[model samples]
Target chain A: MTKEHIVSAFDRDLEGIQATVMKMGGLVEEALRGAIKALETGDTELAQKVRKSDRSVDELDLKVKHDAARILALRSPTASDLRLVLSVIEISAHLERCGDYAKNIAKRSIVLAENAQIEGTVPALRRMATFVLSMLSDALDAYIRKDASLAEAVIERDLEADDMYNTLFRSLLTHMMEDPRSIAAGMHLHFIAKNIERVGDHATGIAEQTIYVVTGALPEDDRPKKDGTSITFKPSDE
Target chain B: MTKEHIVSAFDRDLEGIQATVMKMGGLVEEALRGAIKALETGDTELAQKVRKSDRSVDELDLKVKHDAARILALRSPTASDLRLVLSVIEISAHLERCGDYAKNIAKRSIVLAENAQIEGTVPALRRMATFVLSMLSDALDAYIRKDASLAEAVIERDLEADDMYNTLFRSLLTHMMEDPRSIAAGMHLHFIAKNIERVGDHATGIAEQTIYVVTGALPEDDRPKKDGTSITFKPSDE
Candidate 1:
């Protein structure tokens, strides 16, 4: 093949790989939204759908890795192209993790659906899930556009998700404290909340990879973390 | 430079990256051991030490990624060498996550140290941590030796860790249900248990990478997972 033809072929390979990543990201976003919707509406079937969708997400992740590896081996593209390939692999990994968290949420939602609804918990969780969903969607958009600024914005919003989680965690604790009878349901809701919080984390991870792809370096400072539930606890005696 | 010299330099680069990964893994193992030890002994200072050690692990992870990217760009390694580089990147990422989980355990240890020790909790956690620590150590060993069988063994052991986690989960829930006053502490302990379980997951991840590096293909069957907490919840009234 002519030199130009070979270069174009490599570009095509990268484009194909990236396209698959975007498709995978889309599936993850759908899973997150569907899982939360199922939790909010008590739709076990929808939750099952979200859980089943994860298989496609996992398969796409594998495909992206395989195709990226093939490109790196055959094309030997250097500089920006090399960064793109590496970033694609990392991004795909993050998306796969997000899919897993979404699946976890869906699984818990199915269980929560069977139990009596924990009063006022689903609304707060829904809001957090909505915000996280936007962050993930924006992060994926930034990846396609190579917009570092947009990715930075997504990173900044993770703190908000953490803050929401903190509030939900405290409220859930109080709920269980007030009525020890709700402890089982409370634990399930707490895990679902934690799962949503983790989905936000993976979204921030994707945004970081986007910044690395565009700027060739990760953000210098660690993103703000407001998860204080690990350290803060009200003694029952108090 | 002679082509032979170039190849030798690439070999050195691969060796250096692998060595750094092993060092990072060693730090993670130390952090895990120290965190669990702190929890078991109620040593806040040891917990602090484990938390501080994570920065070094993170730095080593970045170094491995940077060095691997450089090798990819400069050496243009193909086939097995290329796979080795990719595997190093993945292995380093897994070890970095393990470091994070250990740090999380340490953070929780500090908190738990300040609070009253829940009876009979520390021993169970310690046993689980020890098993997980061995899995991580063995996974790293498999990586350095390219021992697929050993890696497969580590992967198999993850199911056992999940089973241990399930047992711990039920026991903790029972503890909390009996005394609502212990809810906060129970939640923290549950998270610590989850964190250790996640460490095992990452170890399995590293082992999977080892299998890929050795055999040029990932195992077709999914590793077994027995984490039933999300799906199984006994009603509080029961």
Candidate 2:
């Protein structure tokens, strides 16, 4: 084969790997959204669907990781190519973790669906999930396009999600205090917030991976502070 | 250098890295135990000590990871040796995460010490922390000794810790429901149990790393259950 042909083949492999990782990311985001929606709507069927879908994410995780490793072993590429392969592998792990967090939320959703009505909890969680999903999607975009600025934007967006979680946590804590009957439900709500918070964390991990791929440096964790103030909702704002 | 000398030199480096990882593991276990003790006893001073000691764990993590990566890049070892180095890197990440969880517990203890009495919540949390500490230490031992069976045991022990978390969570939820004033304190206690539960997860991650090092095969999550009932805990005879 010509040298140009060989290089093109390697590029194609990298593109294929990136595509799979993005697909996996999409599946994880969907799972998280489904799980949170199930909790919000008390839809056990949706929760069950989220749980079953996790297996596909796991399978994709293994496939992408194996394929990346196989490419590395065969091509023995160095520098940028090596970084690209490594980033794909790491991002796959992060996506798999996101899937696990979604599964955990689904498990808690099933329990919450059984006892109490989830009236006030789902909105906060959905907002947090939306922020995390965008971060993950943008990070993947930055990675594919090699856009460092876009990766930095994802890092910056993570603070907003953290703030949302803090607000959600305090509000849920107050809700549980007001209604004894909703204590179990509130705890479940708290866990869902936590899962969403971790989803943001995993998104930040993806951003770090992207930064590493671009600059060969790890990104620092720069989560915002909550300062212990309770978030009170305004009815007009909702 | 002669072949014998070269082999012996590599062996010494491997042994040194293993010893350092074990020492770091012990320090992490101590930090976990001290943090939980501080929480249980409401000792801010002890909590401060645990927080201070975590710096050393972080330093050890950096050193071990660097050494392992250096060995991998410089020595270019194959097969089992390569797996050992990779496992050390992953295991160090898990250990560092465990230390972070310990630090989080210590930080919470300081806050809990200020306002609320956590006497009822601490014992169960301590039990779970102890279980995680043992699993972490045992997993390190299994790694150093190449005992797959022991690593498997550590994996099995994680379920017990998970059960402890669920029980503690339910009890704390009940406490918050019984008295609205206890909500903040209960939340702090809930976070403590969660930190220990996370420590157990890190221990399981370490066990999986150890297994990968020994056999180059990753273990399944293997959480036992039957007929929709999670077999994570048996009713405590206490």
What TM-score goes with each of the models?
Answer: 0.94, 0.86
B-chain TM-score for every candidate: 0.93, 0.88
Candidate 1, which segments miss by more than 4 Å at Cα?
A1-7, A234-238, B1-7, B234-238
Q: Write the per-residue lDDT of candidate 1 for residues A164-200, one digit (tens) a residue.
A: 9988999999988888877888888888898889888
lDDT of 2 by residue, B1-238 (tens): 6555556677888888888888888888888888888877778789888878877887887677557545654565666776676577668778877887887788777777766674467777777777878888888888888888999998888878877787787787778888887887777677777778887777788888878877777787455420111111223201
Q: Candidates' lDDT values, in order?
A: 0.86, 0.75
lDDT tens digits, residue span A1-238, model 2? 6555555778989989999998998899899889888877878789889988988998898788667656755665666676777678778988988998888787777776667664667877877888888888888888878888898888888778877887877787778777777776776677678778878777877887788788976654334422122112222211
Q: What is the DockQ of each candidate?
A: 0.56, 0.31
Instruction: Report fnat in order of the candidates.
Output: 0.63, 0.21
| Model 2 B-chain TM | 0.88
Error of 1 at B123 (Å): 0.7
